[model samples]
Target: MPEKSERQLLPLADSDDRQDLRADCGSCFGLCCVALTFSKSSDFPVDKAAGTPCTNLRQDFRCGIHQKLRQKGYSGCTVYDCFGAGQKVSQATFGGTDWRQDPETARQMFDVFPVMRQLHELLWYLTEALTLPQTRPITAELRRALEKTERLTEGTPAAVAETDVAAHRADVNVLLLRTSDLVRADIRRKKKDRRGADLFGARLRGADLRGVTLRGACLIAADLRGADLRQTDLIGADFRDADLRGADLTGSIFLTQSQVNAAQGDAETKLPPFLARPTHWDRPGP
Candidate 1:
């Protein structure tokens, strides 16, 4: 949410907060590290197959090398967010019966976790869409979608395992697209259109980028100082070495922690309060 929008909801903060969509690792069954496969890449140090737990994963579901993941070349784990699906599948969907306690159900538990995760991710976005007052035109539709998605998250294990998450995502995307159009209509003027463009090393300082869709764009090392990126869709955009000093991303959608961590930002950079400034971000050069 924009900082101003954050302030607007301060009174209703307790009621509307989406903390439920965030991972609660302690309550999780190590679903992410076990159910997701990783190969030898910049993210993971060694290859691990899906359904096999990472060596660092402990019996209690905590990562033994949690603090040293990045130092040990497991940078991927640090950026992963399960949207609170782990605990839901661990406790709610399976009625708190762990895979270890009931080994026969292990495979089904693993299968359901990812599906639930996808559902929760959609819920996270839909919940945020509801928060935007600028999207009042289709707020009622978003509410219905939210209720529908919420009910799906409560489905039985068999139903979750058989769910068509991509189809559901497509249904929700319609509302989100409308919301985007309504929000961006005002700033369409004097804005750059760089949707899906390869902007690697491009110099884009102080540009008007309100409502631009930079989805999946390679923005590696781009100079984006003081840019206006309100409501820009930045999902999957590579931000490694990209300078974000003094940029305003107040209402940008789909800007994740991993993307922010890969970029360069400073004290002057404005961001949504939910995203913490990367600990490794550079100090201003004198």
Candidate 2:
């Protein structure tokens, strides 16, 4: 794909807190590289099993190709960030231990990474929402919800690891519904029963859109680069110009592999289908 534009890389409403979250990766034990898996596909050029450290992961818990992962057959690595969960588990939960010294803790640390990552991801969106003047109508409610979710991140690793993250996510969805009702009331009022309305050009960058019903909607030109689309119903939705770089579309229902292949994405996009990758990214000229 063309070198992603700055606008595309850092979508409107990008938060400095989110960038700060990424900067603390060195404090992490590289949980994502060791805990996740990949298949030989267009997105990742090798097969790696879960709990196996990626070959590019250096002994110091740094990526050997950190600056040029895409050029080294590890484009998937460019898109993967643990959202500070790695450090949270590595330092706070596991007390700065690596799997090499205490192998048994590895499983617990791995299990907790996804849980903490989800909460940190929410923190990213809520923090971004708090910065938008247009979204100020619901700022109080948003702040309250944000604090509540942040508290969840600080919970004991045992509690966080065992909690039903999906249920907690649903609870947060109720809060997001109130926020969306306040902000999207204008658009919602224009369309009678916008349970699944077309939202072309809707400036939803960095918005929390988890579990929203967007079936058959036209999402062209919609800045969704960092919006949470997990478990959302996206059957037949058009995604042209809908920046998905750095967005997580995992577990989303009805999003076909072919549709993603047809859409414009880049190295930062995280797709589902386990093994498929985008084929239509606009690559830069040689």
Candidate 3:
């Protein structure tokens, strides 16, 4: 890893309206710190159960080791992005009343957090789909799905918790699949279909992966250095500890920041204009 950084040459199209989709910890009630569970592993130093507050969580709903999470054996926290679900739950659904202020609603808030998180993640994908010129044929359907998901986020905590998230997710997945096909339709080369493949720790360095559908692929610790990933669909691919140094992922569809954050990359790695390079990439890995 090097201290130098890379910059995107072009601005992210339609990303100006996505400010709310990015997490705002300052306005959040630290729901992720208390609501999620973790197992002791390479990503975490200790095993913890759901609904238990992380040991590093401070009284003000901030991580005491926020600046040193990775060095302190909490790499899991560094990669976890709730996509702004925390602040929305804290400020809007609960009317700004934190779980601490109303202990009775703590369980409800915790339950609703995951539900809201799922909805927000869909919103993220839908928003990105709408930005693609190829998806213009189904843009109206995408907008309708986005609006319905957005409305779901604004429901009562109980309503949100009880939402048929799986049903809604299935409905949105249909549109997302169509969007993926539309985007990859222009590729001159025959694309690889590795959907849900188990390529864990597989050797694929410098591979030509353009226009491939790696959706839900388990790429944990896979060697992908210098691979060309332009136009690849990476919606739910797991990149934990994957080596992506020198990889080119520009124009890759449905790739999220959290996925990039989990992988090992260097300054030479090319990313979509919308994603920020993980700061830890500048430091030596543990």
Top TM-score hit = 3
Q: What would the per-residue lDDT of candidate 3 be over residues 46-126, giving only the tens digit for each residue?
A: 998889888888889999999988988899999999988999899988888998889999999999999999999998898
Ten-residue segment with the worst summed lDDT in candidate 1? Answer: 1-10
Model 2: weakest 10-residue lDDT segment is 1-10
Instruction: Give the root-mean-square deviation of each candidate in angstroms.
Output: 4.8, 10.5, 5.9
Quick one: how many clashes does candidate 2 have? 4
Per-residue lDDT over 94-210 for candidate 1, one digit per residue giving the tens place of the 0 to 100 score: 888888899898999999998998888887777777777677777778878887887887889999999999999999988877766676777766666666788999999998788
Clashing pairs in 3: none
Error of 3 at 226 (Å): 0.9
TM-score to native of every candidate shown: 0.87, 0.62, 0.93
lDDT of every predicted structure (CA atoms): 0.79, 0.65, 0.88
Model 2, range 40-84, lDDT digits (tens) per residue?
Answer: 975588899888898888889998887676577665565555656
